[model samples]
Target: MPGPDLLSSQGLRLDGRRPNELRRIKCKLGVFTQPDGSAYLEQGNTKVLAAVYGPHQAAKSKSSTDGVVVNCQYSTATFSTGERKNRPRGDRKSQEMSMHLRQALTAAIKTELYPRSQIDIYVEVLQADGGAYCAGVNAATLALIDAGIPLRAYACACSASMAWRAGQPEPLLDVGHVEEAAGGVVLTVAALPNTGSIALLEMSHRLHMDYFDVVLSRAMQGCRDIEIILDRAVRDHLAEGWTKQDIVTI
Candidate 1:
C-alpha cells in the first residue's frame, strides 16, 4: 500500500495548513466540577480533557521534602483512534506518555511551595488525530491554572514534521494524523513558552542534524502560538466570572 500523500502540489499539508501553520487550538477551563480544576482542549481533530486534584498530603513513599510530588496519568479512549483500543492506560504507550506528561507539568508547577504535598493530574484523549502528547500537555496546563496553582510560566507543547516541497525541505508545524501516518520523522517539544525554556523533547525517529534545527524551531514556534491562545482563553474565563459579581456592592 502507498503511504499517505502528506504535502500538496501547492506546498500545503494534507489538512490544508501551510508548512509553518498550526492546526486551530480551542480550549476552555473548569470543565469538570468534581476535580479541583479541569480543562478541555481541541487541537484540530484531537481532543483532550485534563483534571487536577491535590496539594494534599502525599504518601510517605512519594512525598518530597523540598517539593510537591507530581503524579500524571495519560489515557486514550477506546474509540479515540481509527482502530478500536481494548484499554486506555495499561499499555506501554500510555505509560510512556504518562512520564512525558509529568515532565512537562512538573517544570511549570511551583512544587517547592507545597512541600510534602502532591498534585494529581489526569489526562484523557477523546480524539486522537495526531499529537496526542502535545494536546495532553496543553490541556493539563490549563487545568493547573484553573486550580489556581502557582507556576513559573505556562507549559505548552507542539509537534513538527519534515516534508519536501520542490526539492526543498520544509518543516511542518503541528502535524495532523494523516501526516503522522506517513512515517515521517516527528519532533515533539514541550516548553515554558513565556520563559523561552524547553521542558521536554521527543521524536518518533532520528532526523538528520541539518534538519533538526529547523524542525525543532518550528515546533517551538507552535508552542508559543498555543500559549498565546491559551492565555486568551484564561483571561476570558476570568472576565466572565468577574462580570457576574457586583464588586461595588461587596
Candidate 2:
C-alpha cells in the first residue's frame, strides 16, 4: 500500500537509508540505581526505557510452580508522539503491547530456574518514530542482562515493510514513522537469532504470500544485526566492570 514516493529513484528510503540498513542504535545500561536493572535505548528517533525488578516473591494468586512469572507493562508518554494521547492506564493498546512484551521476553528467560518468583518488566516509550514495540523488546533485553538474569539467548525484535522501487519489489528494514504512515504492509518479528527460534511475529495489513518470506527474512536479519551490537555493548560494560555502575552510552 505504500505510495511510489516511499522509495526514491536512487533506491533510498524516505529517511535516506538503504533497504537493508538499520537506524543507528544507541543504548545504555544501569541508567538508574533504584531498579535492579534499567536501560535506555534509542533506535533512530524512537526512544524507550526499560526497568526490571524481581525474581522476587510473587503473590499467591499469580505464583507459578512450573516457572517464574513474567509481568510486563508497556506505557507511552503523552508527549511521545507528535499528537498527544491522554489515554488512561491499561488502555487496550497498552495492554496488548504488554502482553506481547511478556511473550517475547519469556522465551529468552530461564524461567524454570526460579519457580514461585515473579519478574516485572516495565517499558515506557519516550519517543515514537516507529517500531516502538521492537525498541521496547531490545531495551528490556538489556535491562534483564543488567539484572544478571540468565537467558537462553538474546531476544531481539525488528520490523520490515514492502515497497516498490523501479517496478520491482523491495523490503525495507527498520520501518520509520514516515514509512509506517504510508499505509504499507508492516511485519514485525521477535526472535532468538542465536538459537534460530522465533519469539513473536505480528503483521499489520495483509501481504501476499509471495512476498512474505522475503519480508520475514529481512526482519530476522535485522535481529541478528542488533544482537551483535548488544553483545558488544555488554562486553564493553563487563570490561569496564559492572560494579562501577556507570551509564554506558554505546
Question: What are the per-model numbers of colliding residue pairs?
Answer: 0, 0
**lDDT per residue as tens, model 1, 59-164:** 9999989999999999999999999999988799999999999999999998899999999999999999999999999999999998889989999999998887
* Alpha-carbon runs more than 4 Å astray in model 2: 243-250
TM-score of each: 0.94, 0.96
Clashing residue pairs in candidate 2, if any? none
lDDT string for model 2 (1-250, tens) is: 5567888899998999999999999998888887888889999999999999988999899998999999999999989999998972488999999999999999999999999999999999999999999999999999999999999999999999999887888899999999999999999999999998999999998798998999999999999999999898888777878632443432
Q: Rate the local accuracy (lDDT) of all candidates.
A: 0.90, 0.92
Name the top TM-score candidate: 2
